[model samples]
Target: MINWLQHAPVYPIVVPLIAGAAMLLLADKHRILRASISVLAALAQLAAAITLLALAAGAGDIWPKGVGVYLLGDWAAPFGIVLAVDRLSAVMLTLTAVLGVASLFYSLARWDRLGVHFHSLFQFLLMGLNGAFLTGDLFNLFVFFEILLAASYGLILHGSGVARVSAGLQYIAVNLVASFLLLISIALIYGVTGTLNLADLAVRAGTLGGTDRLLFEIGAAVLGVAFLVKAGAWPMNFWLVRGYSSASAPVAAIFSIMTKVGIYALLRIGSLLLPTGAPAAFSLEWMFVIGMATLIFGAIGLLATQQLDQLVSYCVIVSAGTLLTALGMPGVRLTGPALFYLVSSVLTTGAFFMLVELVERTQTFGANVLAVTLDLFDLDDPESPNRSDDVVGVAIPAAMAFLGLAFVSCALLVTGLPPLSGFVAKFSLLSAAVAEANASMQPADAWILVAGVLVAGLAGIIAFGRAGMRIFWGNDERTTPRLRVLEAGPVSILLLLCVALAAGAGPVSAYLDAAARSLDDPSLYIDAVLSASPTRAIGGH
Candidate 1:
């Protein structure tokens, strides 16, 4: 039992793997049992994640480096696969689990029935995400990336409509190219360093000759491009909106974290591979430029989009850009606040995605009515006194009112308005950026970032405001959408998480600061992973 407890880091990966395999063996007629198993596995994974987070943060004397290293098959570092859990990985694991729970709960309403093998695919996706976050080596990272991508392919095409199929094809094509690039980059790095372990690579990075270093930098640049495409960066994000908007609501909601996976890779690899003053330091500047461009583009897209689902999709791009911009800057001050913002933005965006499908149900009647009236002119109502009384106020239905309130909450959170976690996050991020600028004599880029953030917030507010007016206030003949407890419960839970994050900002900020500090200094992670003893068995087998 103690040995099993020592192997806490792998449970997040193992639980879902077993659950998915078990789900696959079950027939479609056993959906209820499959769903029960999936939810239980997800909950178990969440518990394991929280436990691992505690262990990584130094709950017990598990390791001295404030990192948990689990070596597979008792193999040592740079020789075998390993799972490393630091504060950053722990946070990501917890976030993934939270989103997984919410998405799975929402799916129970109707989404799971829309397609076959949904439970199995959902579990596999969780396994892939958890594995990606926990893996300590680049090789295993690629393997996990493939796992998630494969699972995502199935999820993206689950419902199988013409639009979904078209988007899935585009998404698959783009990601295949990305996967090829990833392989080339990995091969180049391996050729130069002769090792795929991140810690070993970091240790060997400083010893490369000029030519080898140049080759390595090229490889890293290619790898960054692969990650940026998934991150929904400008010029590389054309597939994101369509793919996400075409997905089922629960799938899209969970996919909100998928972009963050790219951001995580960028942050992890960037911090580990490119120390300050290294040859690859130039890449950070390019990252900043791309990030700013992505932010501006997303803002414009958000304003231009009419569909609520598409608007939420653009917001994901905007969040990615914000993270990339903050990460591109120097120091952990901005990075810390940016991490907090990541949590807030991901939660709110996910809730908004789920909310979109619910709200659209109410608008179908209004939409059909307008479609029929589009070709017919309303010439009879120009000067009639009876037309004045036709504008009688309609009382908002209880369900519509509830959805409107939820939409407003999501809007406030997404747009960074006051009294919400979004506001707190952006305020913290801008404050840190401002202080850094003042310290650095107020650089032009810093001020530009400040303006960009405010402008993006303004764009979100206007866009969501217009969407709300149209969906809730524009028509009095709207039907009250049937609100299911399972569906509404998940959205409320996610939104409540944002509120809770705001309420507990002080502690959460401190935690993120610690995580950021560890990220900024890779030495801690390197020493932790390299110094730990090899596992005595494969996950205590």
Candidate 2:
């Protein structure tokens, strides 16, 4: 047990795998049994993730043997892929676990109403997420992505609503193309490097030159397209708003994890394979261009949307774009802030969806309930006995007030407003870009980024103002019910988390700083994997 804990980087992945299998077995049994098992499993994984983070945070570098190659059956990486838990991967795994548990708990807070199948699909989704984060090989990443995507297909269309089904199909089509591209890109990379091990590829990628560089460039471009689509950049973003708007709140919460995987993969590849010094590697400039376009497009799209949920969805696209833009900045040391902003954005967006669910149940914001309430409040008829359902009129004002608060939080997080973690993150990235600009004597890109930041801020304010006015002060007299307990608890918890992140930005930034430093220098991971005792190296290396 001591040895396991000491060499415990792989436990995060194992816990979810075990939980998924166990949940699948118990799915046919009682709902309480399934919920208990799923929640316990998610929390257990969350605890393990916290432990891993704490360990990684304190330790100088956990992997010392070239990316902690944990060969599953004692085989070396060339023959068997290995799992590496460096700072970036560890932190990401921790985020996944935390988000998974939070989402699971939110779902359990209303299990029976959501259906039993939700639990099963959710468990599988968590498993896929854990695997995706921890996998050391590109092929396995694709496999896990498919598993997660298949589960999401079920989750997205779970209720069989017309809008959901229609939107889900579009989501499915987009991802299917992405999956195909992912496979083709991996094959080309393997053809070039003769290995799928990320670390090994890192070592091998340096040898390519001339036409080989062009080959690599083609593969990288294809791979980037696949990930960018998943990231909801520009032309590919329409499906995200449609699918997310129609999804259940819990489904939306789960969907929140998907794009993060894409962004994480982009970072992983950029850091590991496309070293800054490698001439064969493609530059990050294209990533920046796409990210900027996505930001502008999403902001405009949000301004055009009338529905509250759809507006938030487009904001998510904007955040993804910002991260991409940061990545594209030459010689920039902004990865830390990018990661921090991504985690924070996911937290707040998930919370917003929770709030949306509550508002949907209320009359003031309920597009559906508005119809129901309209018939009840038809003052033109005195014989109407619907006065009993006027519970909505009294609650509408309060619910809309809370909705206003949530909307502000969403804007702050998405647009990087002051006194918020979002702003801190954006500031860090821009500072890095400015420093790089000064060093390289190229000020135009820096100025463009600054302008983009200002425009984004203005767009966020205008969009939020429009949404708030329509949601809170609109003259619509539709009476609906009050915010339910199910909606209030998750939203409250998430709001507190956002507050905590904003207030304690110093410590959080420090942690991200360390993690960022670790990512830039991966020698620690290399040492850890190669330092394991022969007896404990389960897979032969």
Candidate 3:
């Protein structure tokens, strides 16, 4: 048992890989069986992820130094692919699993049957995510990234509509370019450092000072830009709103985590190679600028959007901008809160994406067009009552009531308002910013971030108000929407998670702080990966 337990780092990747392969072989006709297997696999992945998270945080005594590196085929690092797990990777794995469970179960209602091999594609996507999180080798990071991208290609285009196809093609083209850029940067780094292992790169990062450093910095800049593009930063996010909004609800839900994956890569690589007090690889100031641009653009887009799904996509952009803005700060002080915000925003956005589909069912297409026309002409909705109806109105149906409440919950989350995790997250971020400002932070930088956060929150309020009025209040002549248990259940679970996060903010913040502390001390990670035992060294050394 101890021997097998030592290999826990690989389980997150292996479980989904095997599951996907099995589903591929089962023939697309057996959807129920495939869904059953997918759920089982998702549950198992969640279990493994939680266990890994616990182990990384030193909950148990079995190799609980907070970092574990598994050398593939019992070969040591800098030679072959290595799977490493620490607090950050473990948390990411856990988040992906939770999102996967929600997305897959929701798909069981209809999205999976819309296309062939959906279960397989879904499982493969999870496999790719797990692999990307666990890989300790740079080259293999690219490998796992491609794996995930390939799966996402199928997922984004699952419904096969004209919009979905166009958006999917754009998504595919952008990522392929990013992947090529990643390869170029990797090659440049390898040429200079002669190593591809992340730990090894960190070790060598400080030693370069001359032309090598220049080349490396260039490489790092290219790498950062590629990921920022993937992160849906401004200019790069032109396709994001359309792509995400066009995708099926489940696909869009799972895709909420995809941009985070790109941001995660940047965080991981940056923290490793440029730890606190280390030489800077990419300028935090430029990163902040990128974030600010994205945040402002997304806010404007939010106000301009009439569609709920499009608004949700802009919310995603704002969330990314928030994360990037926070990450632009030096030190681990604000990173903890950034991580917290990531979890809160992702859960809410995923729920909102799925909820858009449900809410749209109640309103008619003509009503939406009319609402747009009213806005263009600056005219009031004729059916809208001019005064308050103190008496009584048409009784709200259960489905509409559910949809309205869910929409409000999502709005509260996106707007960083009270009674949800989003409020807590934003407050934490602001508190951290103030604390940082008290200690040598530039006034301009601090205020910019502060203003960005506030304005973004305000944008959420305006956007949600506009969308809500159009969907719920503006059109009273609509039919009652149908709500399937599976469809409704996933969104409920996701939002409930937000509530739970708010309730458990204390412990969750503590965990995230520990994660930040570990990151602040990258030497711990480097030491573990280097000291890990291997049955045979490279070339049988």
Candidate 4:
């Protein structure tokens, strides 16, 4: 049992892979069995993830530095495949599990029947996501990147609509280009360093000659472009809105985390492979500029769009921009709060995506009517006593009310308004930024970040307000769209998780603070991975 527990790192990847493969064997008619397997597999992955989080948090004496290094085939690090889990990876794994459960549960309502191999693709996506989060080597990272992208291509085109097909093709084309760049970057790095392991790369980063360093920097820049495209940063995020909005609700919800995977790669690789000081901080200025541009662009898109799906998609871009700006700054203080904000924003964004479909089901006709009404009669009905019955004192229907409340919750959460985790997250982030500025006596880019966050939050508020009024308040012809328990259950679960994160912010923030500190000091991670060899394992670091 002790030996088996040591292999826990691989289960997050292996369980989903096996379940997905098994699901492939089942006939399409066996929907019940496939769904059951998918749910159980997701639950098992969640359990394993939680256990790993606990272990990485120092629940036992296995690792004293809050890091777990698992070597495959009993092979040593810098030579064999390794899965390294720390607080950050554990958090990502737990997040993936939560999303997997939510997305799978929501799909059971109707999405599972719309396509063949839905469950199999879903499981494979989870496997790929978990593998990407846990893998400690760049080669495996690229492999997992492809795996997830392949799975996503299927998910995006699951419903078989024209919009989905067109958007899916564009999405696939863009990622394929990114993948090619990823391969080129990896090849350049390997040619220079002669190693693919992240820890070994970090250990060797400081020893590169001038020519090798230049080559490595170019490779890193190419890699950054690929990651930025996936992360939905400006000038490279042309594929994000169309692809996400065209996808089905559950698929879009899950794809919310896909952008973060790119951000995670940027964060992890930047911290691990780059040493401290001037030469190491390449392209950060460019990242900051592009991130700010993305934030404002997303804000404008959110306010300009009438479609709820597009609004949610823009919110994702804004969230990514916020994180990029925070990370672009130099300090663990801001990075810690940024990490917390990342969790809150991603959860809210996912919940909003799921809610959009449910809300749209009832508002479709009403929205069309309102559009016509606005076009004919412009700004002259405020005091008209002969107003139609549809515009006056109509009681909100049960479904409308429920959706309205959920929309309000999502709005507050997305806009960083009061009485939610979103507010707490933004407040913490801004406070840290202000504190950092005052401490240094040179504000530099902190003010720009603060402005970007505030303006973006305002844009979210305006967009949600416009959308909510049109859907729930403006139209009196309310039809109660049948709400399935499975569909509603997953949205509720995701929202509750945000509430729990808010309620438990102290502990979570503390943990993230430690994680940020550990990230800043890469030696802790490097020493942990490199010293985990059998010979060194007998005599610990």
Q: How does each model score on TM-score?
A: 0.92, 0.87, 0.92, 0.92
For candidate 1, write residues 1-541 as lDDT tens digits.
4667678989999999999999999986676799999999999999999998888778877755678888877788888888999989999999999999999999886667666789889988999899989999888888998988999999998764578899999999999998888889899889998999989888898888789988988888788888888788989999999999989889999899999998998888888866734445335788788899999999999899988989999999999989888888877779889999999999998999999888877877533532333223231345632122222223334877779889999999988998999999999999998888888864777777899999999999999999999888896767776667888889999999999999999999998999999987899988877876664533544
lDDT scores of the candidates, listed in order: 0.86, 0.70, 0.85, 0.85
lDDT per residue, candidate 4, 193-286, as tens digits? 8999999987776788789988988887888888888899988998999999989889999998999999999899888865733233244667
Candidate 2 lDDT over residue span 1-541, tens digit each:
2456544656766666666677667644455677787788778777777766666665445443223445666555655756666566767777777777667766654432333367768877877787777787788888888888988888887654567789999999989999999999988878887877766667777777877767777787788788878878887777899999888777887677678888888777677765534322235777778888988887788678777788778778877887788777765267777777777888878887767766565444465643433453442244643222332333334666676677677677767787766777777767776776677766777667767766876787888777667656774774444654545566767767777887887888778777777666655554454443444455422
Using alpha carbons, what is the TM-score of model 2?
A: 0.87
Error of 2 at 491 (Å): 1.7
| Candidate 3, 1-541: lDDT as tens digits | 2566677899988888998899888964475788899999999999999999998888767656799888888877777678999989999999999999999988776567666788888988998889988999888888988999999999998865477799889989989998999999899989988998999899887888889888888887788877888899988888799889988899999999999988888888888877522334355777778889898999999889888889999999999998988998888889999999999999999999999877876778734642443344333534443211211123334988899899999999999999999999999999898888888547677678889999989988988998888778888777686567878899999999999999999999999999999888888888989887785543333
User: What RMSD does model 3 have?
Assistant: 7.8
Summing lDDT over every window of 10 consecutive residues in candidate 2, give the lowest-scoring window.
385-394
Decide which is better by TM-score, 1 or 3: 1
Clashes of each: 0, 20, 0, 0
